[model samples]
Target: MKALVLSGGAGTRLRPITHTSAKQLVPVANKPVLFYGLESIAAAGITEVGMIVGETAEEIQEAVGDGSQFGLKVTYIPQEKPLGLAHAVLIAREYLGDDDFVMYLGDNFIVGGIADLVEEFRTNRPDAQILLTQVPDPRAFGVAELDPSGQVVGLEEKPQQPKSDLALVGVYLFTPAIHDAVRSIEPSWRGELEITHAIQHLIDASAEVRSTVIKGYWKDTGNVTDMLEVNRTVLETMERRIDGEVDEASETIGRVVIEKGVRITNSRIVGPVVIAAGSEVSDSYVGPFTSVAENCRIADSELEFSIVLRDSSIRGVGRIEASLIGRHVEVTPAPVVPSAHRFVLGDHSKVQIRS
Candidate 1:
């Protein structure tokens, strides 16, 4: 079986970071989100892979050139635009010819890998198989409705009123039979051929459409909040390894991995944190669930539950939390001004001021 990875999207939700970089290239735990998906695909013993790329095609190609790093041979398929999921499959028909393939969204993070899912699909040979997870907000995802017997009976993409909380996860498995389904379906009102519609077509034709409700963690890191959450989740599994230098003035506690060339002086780092190579943490409080990427500097600040990208520096900032700092960014304290309150009082107006 082959794998088709979708790495193209406007990523408007993550702007202005996405303005400068592909959303798939955003790092979680100092590693690109797309890399994780590629690694997962390789782990499933699939070596021949096709990548669907869009406007940020060059960037994606540069980062994942040849895909040999993951022990896979990658073929790049260019999409003029991110029409939809089914549209991606439509263009990739040549590369995916006559072969069952796994479609993985590059930016999505599934805690457990897709090895078991691939194995199940190979064993069952369903026409199409989708992974589903219970989500609080079903309207934001493609949702599925199962019958009393737990069979997939209906599917909708971003419905206003969902029939069920079971939303489709980013991973999908499909046989060559799906080619006809894609050709038979019409574009939705959004002018894109959604994959959910194609799956619904199969359901109407009495084809074997299967669903697996995964209880493991899954997230689409398309926005800042989700990105930070996924980062924290991945960091939670990190083992403590301090290969860097920590001065006597610093205190490191809990499960923190300090990569080589790191220097910590007069700073305190809490558990489940990862400081990448060549970073310097001095006179700061690095709290839990934070990842400081390579060559970064943190001084005279307090940061927690945030991701600081490579070459970024945070100095003299009092406190920061739940933030996604991009690469080569500098954060510093705002200049102080004299305290004053100036106001023009209107007639019969009462005001109270704190001195």
Candidate 2:
């Protein structure tokens, strides 16, 4: 079996940062989100992978050269545009051929991995097997409707009135039967051929469509909040290892992993934190659930529940929490100046001020 991973799409939700890098390349726990999916695929015993890339093709190619590092032979399939999930399968027809393949979204993170799901699909060999999870807001995702027997009956992509609370997860298992379904369906109002529609087509055609409601942790990592959450989840499992230099004035607690070449002086790091190589943390407080990427500097500041990308520096910036700082960015204290409150108000307008 082969794997088809979608690494395209303009991540408008993660603006500014996405403008500079692919969403799939965003780091969670100092590792690209795409790498997690690729590692899952390898663990599932799939060796050949066809990665779908768009505008950020060059960057993806450079990072995942030959895919040998993950024990898989990768073939880069360029998509001129991110039409839709179904469109990705349509274009990868040749690469997928007649072999059963798994379609994974590069930016999605599932805690336990898809090895078990892959095994279930291999055993049953259904025409199409989709993963679903109960989401608080089903309107933002492709939702599936099930019958009294818990069988999938209908599917919709970002429906105005969703039929069910089960949102489709990023991983999908499909056989050769899906080719015809992709060709038969028309694009939705969004002018894109959604995968939900393709799967619905299979249901309408009486083909076997199966689904598994997963209880494991899964995240799309599309926005700042979700990115930080996934980072915290990954860091929770980290083991305590201090390979770097920590001065006697410094102290670290909990599951902290300090990579080589890192220096910590007069700083206190509470664990479930990871400080990557070549980073320096001095006279700072690195709180729990924070990830400091490579070559970063944190001095005279307090950071908690934040992710600082590579080459970024946060010095004397008081306390920062629940943030996703991009690469090569500098964050420092603002210049001290006179404090004053000036306001222009209209009739009946009210204001609340806090210092």
Candidate 3:
């Protein structure tokens, strides 16, 4: 089976950051989210793959060139626009001709991987197989309602009134028959043909559509909140190692990894943290659940539960938590000045005084 990884969507939810970078390339535990999907697919024994990319095609092309790094040969399939998941299937028809394929959304994080799912699909060979999980807000995702016989009876995308808490996870397995299903459906009210609609077409036509509800952790890292949460989750499982430099004056606590070329001096770093290459932490406190990327500088600052990208700096800042700081950025204390009283008094005796 071939793997079709979707990296095309314009991530509007992760704005400001996505404005400059692709959402799939966002780091969790110092590795890109898309890389996790590629590696997982490789481990599943799928090597012939295609990646669907959008305006940020060049960025992905550079990072995943030829896909040989992950033991896969990749073909770049460009989607002019991120119309819908159905549209992606439509465009990749030639590459996926007559073969079963697994479609993975780039920004989705699935803990415990999809190895078992692939094995099940290969054995059963269903027309379509979807991964489902019980989410608190089913209306926010593609939801599936089951029949009394445990079959998928209905599916809806971001519906206002959802029928079930079972949200469709980002991974899907489909047979060649799905090509006709995509062509048979009309665009939805959103002006694009949704994959859910296409899958519904298959179900209505009596095609076998199976679903597996997972108990493992899964997240669509489409926003800052989810991104940070995934980062923390991945960091929690990091193996304990100190592979790089640490000065005598620096105290390296449990499970800290200082990558090659990293220098730490006069700093207190508690781990389950990774400090990337060429980064220097001097006179700072680098706490747990944080990843400091390459060529960064942290001086006289304290950071915890945060992610700092390459070429960034944090100096003289008191503390930071649960932040996703971008590349080439700087965070430092504001200018110090003499104290002066400034007060505001409002109704009900509400007052804020700043000095």
Candidate 4:
């Protein structure tokens, strides 16, 4: 089976960060989210992969290269616009011709990987299979409704009134029969061909459709909050490895991975934290669940539960938490100004002032 990885969406939720960088390229624990998906595909023993890319195609191509690093031969299928999931399949028809494939969202993170799901799909050979997980807000995602026999009976995308809590996870398996289904469906109200609609079309035609409710961890790292959460989740499994230099004045706590060429002096770092190579942390408190990317400098500052991208510096700053700092940025103490309170009192106005 082959793989089709979608990396083409404009991540509006990620805001200013996605303005300059691809959302899929955002690092979780110093590794791009897209890399994790690629690794999972390779682990599933799929070698030929097609990546659907949009305006950020150049950046994605540069990062992934030929995909040999992940043991897959990648073909980049450019999408002028991110119309919808079904539109992606429609455009990649030539690349995915006649082959059963798994569609993975590049920015989505699933803890246990899709090896078991792929294996199950290969064995059962359903016309289409979707991974579902119970979400707190089903209205924000494509939802599924199953029959009494656990068969998928209907699907809807971001419905106003959801019928179930089962949100479609970002991984899907489909056979060649889906091409006809996609061709038969029209665009949704959102002006795009929704994948949920295509799957629903299959259901109406009596084609075999299946759904699996995954119990493991799964997240779509589209926004900053989810990105940080995914980073924290991935760091929880980190092994303690200190390849960098830690001075006698520094105290490093549990499950910290300090990469080579890093220097820590007179600082305290609490882990599940990862300090990448070429970074220096001096007289700083790098708290738990933080990832300081390569070539960053943290001096006389305190940071926790944050991600600092490459070449950024946080010097002489106060505590910062639950943040996503972009690359080559600087966070330092602001210049002090004379303190004063100036006010014009109106007639019959009562005022209290501290002297």
What TM-score fits each model?
A: 0.98, 0.96, 0.95, 0.98
Between prediction 2 and prediction 3, the one with superior TM-score is: 2
* Residue 83 displacement in candidate 4 (angstroms): 0.4
Looking at model 1, residue 76 earns an lDDT score of: 99
Candidate 4 worst ten-residue window by lDDT? 346-355
* Candidate-wise lDDT, in order: 0.96, 0.96, 0.92, 0.96
lDDT of 1 by residue, 229-335 (tens): 99999999999999999999999999999999999999999979999999999999999999999999999999999999899999999999999999899999889
Tens digit per residue, CA lDDT, model 3, 1-355:
9999999989999888888899999899899999999999998989999899999999999989999999999999999999899999999999999999999999999998899999999999999999999999898999999988889999999999999999999999999989999999998898887999999999999999999999999999999889888888888888777777888998988878888899899999998898999999999998888999999999998999998999999998888888899999999889989877665766789655553
What is the lDDT for 352 in model 3? 55
CA displacement after TM-score superposition, residue 122 of candidate 4 (Å) = 0.5
Query: Which has the better lDDT: candidate 3, or candidate 4?
Result: 4
Taking the tens digit of each residue's C-alpha lDDT, what string does model 4 give over 1-355? Answer: 9999999999999989889999999999999999999999999999999999999999999999999998999999999998999999999999999999999999999998999999999999999999999999999999999888999999999998999999999999999999898888999888999999999999999999989999999999999999999999999999999999999999999999999999999999999999999999999999999999999999999999999999999999889999999999999899999989888888999888788
Lowest-scoring 10 consecutive residues by lDDT in candidate 3? 346-355
TM-score between model 1 and native = 0.98
Query: Which numbered prediction scores highest in TM-score against the true structure?
Result: 4
lDDT of 2 by residue, 1-355 (tens): 9999999999999889999999999999999999999999999999999999999999999999999999999999999998999999999999999999999999999999999999999999999999999999999999999999999999989988999899999999999999999999998889899999999999999999999999999999899999999999999998999999999999999999999999999999999999999999999999999999999999999999999999999999899999999999999888999999998899999898898
Give the local distance difference test score of model 3. Answer: 0.92
